[model samples]
Target: MEESQLERNRRNGFLALVLRPINWLKMLGEEVHWSFVIGVMIVYGISQGFAVGMSKVSTMYYMKDEQKVQPSELQVYLGLLQLPWVIKPLWGLLTDTLPVLGYRRRPYFIFAGFLSVTSMLALSIQRNLSLAFSLLSLIGVSAGIAIAVVAIDACVTQNSISHPSLAGDMQSLCGFSSSIGALAGYSLSGFLVHLVGPKAHVDSIPSAARLYCFFSSFYPLHNLSGVTLTSQGVFGLLSVPAGLVILVGMMLKESRVHKFTHRGVNEKFLDAGKAMWTALKFRDVWRPCLYMYLSLAVSLNIHEGMFYWYTDAKGGPSFSQHGLFASKNSNLSLITYHEISSWLNSDSELGCSDVLFWYGMQEVVGSIFSVGAVGSLSGVLIYQNWLKDHRFRDLLFWSQLLYGASGLLDLILVLRLNLKIGLPDYFFVVIDEAISMMIGRIKWQPLLVLSSKLCPAGIEGTFFALLMSIDHVGLLSSTWVGGLLLKFLKVTRTQFDNLWVAILIRSLMRIIPVFLLFLIPRSDPNLSILPEEMLKMKKGDNTLESENTEMVSLVDST
Candidate 1:
């Protein structure tokens, strides 16, 4: 009898495991509209895949190899592209407070999609586009994504509020979609780049040439006298994701807003602004906000410098697009920095012959990114199951400490120390990437949860946007400071003697936030961060009636 009972229990557990995914899908279908699910998949999953996996990688290579952009300059340009995100509050406020042509969320999605599609198409089709024009186009694309992100976040937040019981499931679905999308996109990125090439035929200019044309006029469209770099068809594929964003807008079901008045709009903005300001005055709110900002800013984002060093440095392993890990059947030999330099000096025939080899190397990096996506999902699970219950201060202190320690892997990779430990560069890099990505997601997850708990009832959207904007501001600061550090250290495109020093400095700076853990509340995740009065103020804010319930959740959902 005992043996039979144990067998039945074992069978039941196995069946439960097999049925979990189906249960998840059923719950999602029952909880939210089909259109909402589709919108989330496209916005969170597919968009992330294209942006990170394909567009980001291709653009970096295009700037580096074709345009000869210095590491510092690239950092600045990329930071500038994130301008729209830094002011996400504006997008959030507009979406929540104002309706366009009688519709709110749907029209914004349409606008975002249209803007992204236009920018990508222009970038792909233009043959001799100027450097400034290319940068602006990329910025436009980013703006579109940012707007769409704000809208989707609003949707998720509203759903979470309405279907409080299924909030966790909805959040999970969103994260899963993003993770799977990123994995698929990154897995295919290198192959796509290999097939299409990374270069674009932009008229390159001198680094010292000021892009005043961007502000003054569009007259200087291209420098015809400048060298025409290698062109690729990869840029054309970017339009597909943007087009899907449009489909998301069309598919999303939203009721028409019949109310309209300029005075009402002003009143809504005023109320949101007042509520946001009020929330900031609380020590619990402002202290953590300040800590989050300093933590991000001090970390310093010297990724561009590191990327150049990875691919171009003569003193290090040149993990170029074509040569790091050569397959057995490949005609080209495994290339080092010396070989890469010589190949560049060789004729077009030699370069053309090596394209396949270059793509094989790129695949290794793409695989690393794909692995990181899985690592990120693992992080979410680990946090949800274990760390979510811990006190905020303790959780952050240990995570921040570990975060700094993870930087040592990059240092080890750059120094080729793994080779001494019998680890191949490819194997070591993949592990390093996965571990770092997992730790990063873990560290970021708590802050997102904390941010959500801090949101007041009526002004959730506006105040959350304000908090996110603070975070973006920190990111902008980090990017600019990293650029300055690279320039100051003279870690240019080819010169990487001081690369390790920059890495060491960044790692040390990441540890500085550990000392600021006192700013975080000691309360449990279940406790509200805001004061009781702030929570109770939901009744009086009539101006924010239409806007308050649908606040943004950009980071929280991810």
Candidate 2:
């Protein structure tokens, strides 16, 4: 009886541990009254997840498998696609400064959703590589997903100024929702990509014509069966999130005051331009922004291209030993694909799709059970419970250092050093991903918290958008630089001889940002300045002047 009771107690403890984060989010949602802020976040989170998953699967697998595009060339296209995100400050300016039909947020949200849906649909049917690239880039631009996200963030930041205790909790909820969405999307993406074979194989029709036919009619009608899911069909299904974004835009309630501004369009644009200039002039805001940019600028991600090359290389260990273990062990079947079409193709050349499949498996497992999910959750908890009081700069430095350390695992794998220690490629990837994800969460949460605190009054959305855009610039630059490095090193699908050189350069680059930590604030702004004190600080700020009267009127009306 006592043993049974102990077992029951253990089970209860496990359940409590699992449900704690969910409960926290529930409490936060109720406290926030499930307002537009929370609603926007949830919808945006899911949409962002779906978009990221779609991009990853399509680029890494479909493009490689179908188009036979080399890694170097693909990287170039990926970098080009980031242009919209890099220029996101323009979107911020337009959304914040210009109102459509007297509504700033709603109309933009609707337009963005419409664009995203249309872009995804176009991607489904288009067989031309140039057109596909253009559509993908259009998705990044028109999705205005970032616009919605930044707007919600601005609302949260404004609310946080008044309710200081809820600031961290609200940010936690945002991260939690985003993580959930990403995990779900990633899981579904793997399944979808696997279901849709890497390249469409039509015996009768030419590949291009068949692709058009599948996307135009066959996919939508669900005519294809068993291991014949078309890429266009998957893309068609992926459009559902954009539809949800449109629904959210139409249904979400916003303040009527947000509907009308006393200023003329010219005045609004002038004020926005001034607001951006004033915000950048502030040491507190632009300092962190500069730091984030520099840190990201110096960071190298050449390892990503290298990893793909390593996996797909014809003579590589992963390639040579692909079927050896699976042939001997029945248990291996549980982890890998079951269908014969999944592993075999007519050409008999080792297909890149198989490598992508296993990689997806690693990603799904790591995202759900191993590191990405658990680590991200724990990151929020750890920050809230133990590290919230600590210096933000110190925490960021440590987290980034740990993140760089995680890259060493990739280096080890690239060097085939893991094989010497009897670590299979699969285990190394899964473990490395788990660790990297956990550290990544730790690194990212503080950055978001800092960005939230840095938003000045009156122009919170515009300023936050600028900050995010700057961050994207860093990412965009990194992607472009990584692609350049691959091209320079001549790292291709077959030739990875110089891959380690690129990896070494990236590893060294990751540590350069650590030395530049002086740019980040040493203290948490929310705690450092009391709410009343913050109001005092804002009194002399010019950017807050244009909207002050309207905000005051809105407050009085409420």
Question: What tens-digit string does per-residue lDDT give for candidate 1 at 250-305?
Answer: 65555676556656888888888888887888889899999999999999999999
lDDT of 2 by residue, 263-311 (tens): 6556666766775686677777678889888877777656447546544
What's each prediction's TM-score?
0.82, 0.79
Against the true structure, whose lDDT is highest? Answer: 1
Cα error, candidate 1, residue 368 (Å)? 2.5
In candidate 1, what residue range of length 10 has the lowest lDDT sum? 212-221
lDDT of candidate 2 at residue 321, scale 0 to 100:
21
lDDT (C-alpha, whole model) for all candidates: 0.71, 0.59
Q: Give the worst 10-residue stretch by lDDT in candidate 2.
A: 209-218
**How many times do residue backbones clash in model 2?**
0
lDDT score for residue 272 of model 1: 81
Error of 1 at 246 (Å): 1.5
